[model samples]
Target: MVLQGMAAFRIICVVLLAALAGASTAQRPTYRAPQHTRAPLPVGATPEDFVAFANGGMQIERDRAPDDELAEHRRLVSALDGLLPQRKGMVDAYVVSIALDSDPVFGREAREAAKVLARRYDAAGRTIVLAGSDGTGPSDLPRGSPGHLALALARIAELIDKSEDGLVLYTTSHGAPIGIIYNDADQGYGAISPNRLAAVLGALGVDRRLVIVSACYSGSFVPALANADTAILTASAGDRTSFGCQSDNDWTFYGDALINHALRKAQPLAAASAEAVALVGQWEQQGRLKPSLPQVLIGDRATAWLAQLDRRTPAATTASVGRPATALLDQR
Candidate 1:
């Protein structure tokens, strides 16, 4: 009787160990965009616009003298390009890069990401808009363009008017207590307060939105974007700098790893968020850098919706494209 009991316990222990091993092994290294069973954007509906805003353009050029930041920006854009949706109504993307210098690191990545997304979703008939500053201009706006904020706001309004649904907004730059830094003045730095930004985006009524802000003090934008019904993701919490960018690199650890994993087939949004947190934590531990926290704010319904999407994803790369579950989304 004693021998039988011991044997049973041994079997249970082995089973538990195997299960733990499998779970750990199956863990993905990065964030995966939530998979949804919901149908792709409607056939005739205009596709969402992907808006990318990079605040530092000159970093790329400066790096050239000593291996500029441009290389990393370029890499980032390339990765985005490959992840772009192929069809128009599915996922249309646009990119805008702004910086103190003409070819700053941020601007370059913005352009590159835009180009890559355009190629992947070219057949979808979505338009890719690329905007940037040459640095020495007024407020860093494009030559002959309107005021900085006006032009930036106008571009967003135009995109929203053209396609009301399916939009993702990405902003990467330096941030402080107020908002993002537009320029450096002898007296002080110019920044965009989160309230002002929220109002701007709210007015556009971007019903479906993904807004990513990567910078120090980025947490400030979360409340605004969330209030405006925009799904918000921030690179760091309040008063923290988002680190990781070298010449020609695709991303700092956060953005690069997130983007790479998010696009993998049938990834759940929750899973993506969890993975992002884990990756950031690991990077900090290894490098001794201050830890940066990534946060996600999604609508209540988005959670289960993302989970269902996993079922629709092709099990393998070779799997044929299947019909989207538009009806299922409607049911939800």
Candidate 2:
């Protein structure tokens, strides 16, 4: 009888422990990966082929006939031919908008923001876009691959008389602590390190620069990109994630607040940044999410340059016309 009782007790204890474990697991938040639509590609395509397609660079296919390679090369050449010619004289500001992800949301936001910046800065002939194929349309170039982005910057650097021209580079994508994610869907995938970006800027020799990185953990770029002649703006701090990255949305939390709202006004970027940061905080609090804490670093030289730029360009006399503020309140 004693042995039977002891066995029964052990079984009961095991059952209780199992129940507690199950309860604990139920209390823990479950993680669901965000669903993404995978882009289509040719069968048996290699990574090299994907890279070539994404960058619009060399064509590589060992099995394919020479004619096939030539055809692809010609197509890329035609695309390159369509790019806008660089301006000859000093430009007020040259804007290069890059949407590094294949997500349509980032592409749309980047393109819209680029247009706004161009209009505000009177840089109609000086703006370039490198983005993925979102339903919206083709950018100045297809594929925001690292190679293409680097090439675009180099080309702009070579064309512009760097003495008086300022470059505004706005990049939007997903990010990790190491770097901003660069994925052209099935075409190619990579990351742009902060150091790589700094080197690009250094090689460009453009002293007056505004670098805006809209991505999670983008604050990691600030320390590397910030300098006497540069201003760096990031969507979130190194340890947090920003929201509103849905494909159906017009913009992310930071992009909407900063580029679509604050920057749309005639205020200096510094003031606009502050306003956007505050707005983001409010949105995050309302949603009961952890604070993203958008970040900005304004270099000494950029301050004077921005002041001069603001003086040259007057603020919009009219209010922004678009989705009402209420519509964007729940966006994040």
Candidate 3:
């Protein structure tokens, strides 16, 4: 059997290649606004805002945001009009990938992950990505935030036929025990607790879905989202933490093992997940760091939809790319 518990050995490593990624923001909102009335980060936020979040708490006040900011957000959200409708009689997969933090690492991971997921699920025009500038040229894609995620899900719901179509949602961010965090550099602070996410999906009726969350303490989402028709994968258990969130790196430990390595092959989710967990455990041991204890939950009813999506993944696996996450930890 695979190792049972595994994450916290950073003390021995001379090279602090990455900081322990920390989650940001305050409590989740009690009620969610409708997609039409959703909001994004303010156009102008002071560095002090980031300091506040760094200090462990911030009440995001984008509700009184300026007109121009709201206008820009509207344009970005409106761009989702390009998400093509599903062809009748065929099962469709809509991929939504987002980087909740402004860290370039998450941006790179989220962008590439969208491509991988889209190709795997055959979701060409059915894909939507939300991320911030990673020192790359101007991008029309809106920054990741709770509002935009809600908007994307709501839009996909309209286009996808609930009977057979599915949603592949991938999120990369620093997670707290509370939930996956929503932090954009200095502004847009909040957490998407399991309850909140469960409510949203339950409300939208997006039953056939695959959600992969990369963040510390991400497994906490399992109990809420797990069901006969849903599959959930997390980088770490609810109390443990993951690695390779260094802002400068290309992939987090979990991202590299799962997406860049295991999923690249035409294997079943169980095999891929097993490979990823093994890789993560190996790295944690090598780095003398505690294991993040990656978690996976596959419901029985999800097997059919998973098989359908698996049939379309690339025939040949791609060569692994990017710096090794453990090496980053090894470097001083």
Candidate 4:
């Protein structure tokens, strides 16, 4: 958005390529269909429909909220403008965490993930969180939607130095072969495909980034988001289902392992990711659930920024808090 001219064109071109190529590996898993426990998923949607949606985003006619509610939502989204500019001449991390669905589980995960990431990246003033209510009283934050995500990225693009600053994005939601599903019962429904996400990041000129997507079929995003300067981690493989998405829960299987446990320490991101993957594997095995096969890819160019952020990481470890992800399994 900084240079809306050529950059917008490039984003459009990328989306076109994704639609024409239809390269997303996200598959509707055979084990369990995404349902209404946590978030409403596109139960019967196909991958082709997903690509088409990615090419031309949803134009849903959302039910109108009260005038006061609308104003409040706008105020919350506008809060992105309050984020501080990146400290010049330093390699800073700009953390953006969003809960894509209104499922209280995602909202909870996104809220904590934002804090965990902010601490790890030393992004105190550079962090922006967009999440709905976590079912714990009223929320002051705005809900995570495709539109808000774009606004957050665009604002970061304006403030951060493209070459010097890095982005750490965490998106938690339900999924389909399509992508991350955004279902707010009161608001409406939509989707964010891998290509659309890739295009937005590319258009923003944010090359150094660490993107974590937590949802079923999340691995499908890897191919589209992969870049020489990027690192990516997902909750599951293209056709797999990640567990622990109950609405009353605090974290998804991926979030509990990666953010609540591994990331609360003084360590490199790759090491934390490794530990998380192992934890998820053990959980799935014990529960006799399908393997999510969470995926992680760190490019050669990512090392520089990773090192910089690792240096900023706190030396002490934070004890894991709240309900455990395994609680979901016990309930079942």
Judging by TM-score against the true structure, name the best candidate: 4
* Model 2 misplaced regions, further than 4 Å: 1-91, 136-141, 317-332
Q: List the residue pairs that clash in candidate 3.
A: 6-291, 7-290, 7-291, 8-290, 9-289, 9-290, 15-331, 15-332
TM-score of 4: 0.84
Candidate 1 clash figure, as a count = 31
RMSD each, Å: 20.0, 13.3, 9.8, 9.3
* Whole-structure CA lDDT of model 4: 0.77
Error of 1 at 258 (Å): 1.4
> What TM-score does prediction 2 earn?
0.73
The lDDT for every candidate, in the order shown, is 0.41, 0.66, 0.74, 0.77
User: Whole-model lDDT for model 3 versus the true structure?
Assistant: 0.74
User: On residues 171-286, what C-alpha lDDT tens digit does candidate 3 reach at each position?
Assistant: 99877555666755444666576767777888999999999999987888898899998989999998787988876677899999998888888999889999999999998888
Winner on TM-score (2 vs 3): 3
Ranking the candidates on TM-score from highest down gives: 4, 3, 2, 1
Instruction: Give TM-scores for every candidate, taking all chains together and pairing residue i with residue i.
Output: 0.52, 0.73, 0.80, 0.84
- Of the candidates shown, which would achieve the greatest lDDT relative to the real structure? 4
Residue range 1-332, candidate 2, lDDT tens digits: 01133443343233223222211111113421112333233456554433333333222122435774465445444544444555455346778888877566677778877887777666676777777544444333455667667766776776666766788899997765446666554445565767678777787787678999998778888987888889999999976877665554557888888888888788888998999999888887877878999999999988876776677565663345334323435644
Those runs of model 4 whose alpha carbons end farther than 4 Å from true positions after fitting are 1-47, 59-61, 66-69
**Model 3, position 81: C-alpha lDDT score:** 89
On the 0 to 100 scale, the lDDT of residue 312 in model 4 is: 80
Clashing pairs in 4: none
Q: Candidate 1 — what's its lDDT?
A: 0.41
Per-residue accuracy of model 1 over 226-310 as CA lDDT, tens digit each: 7333457777886565654221222445554444344333456566667767777776766667877777787664443333334
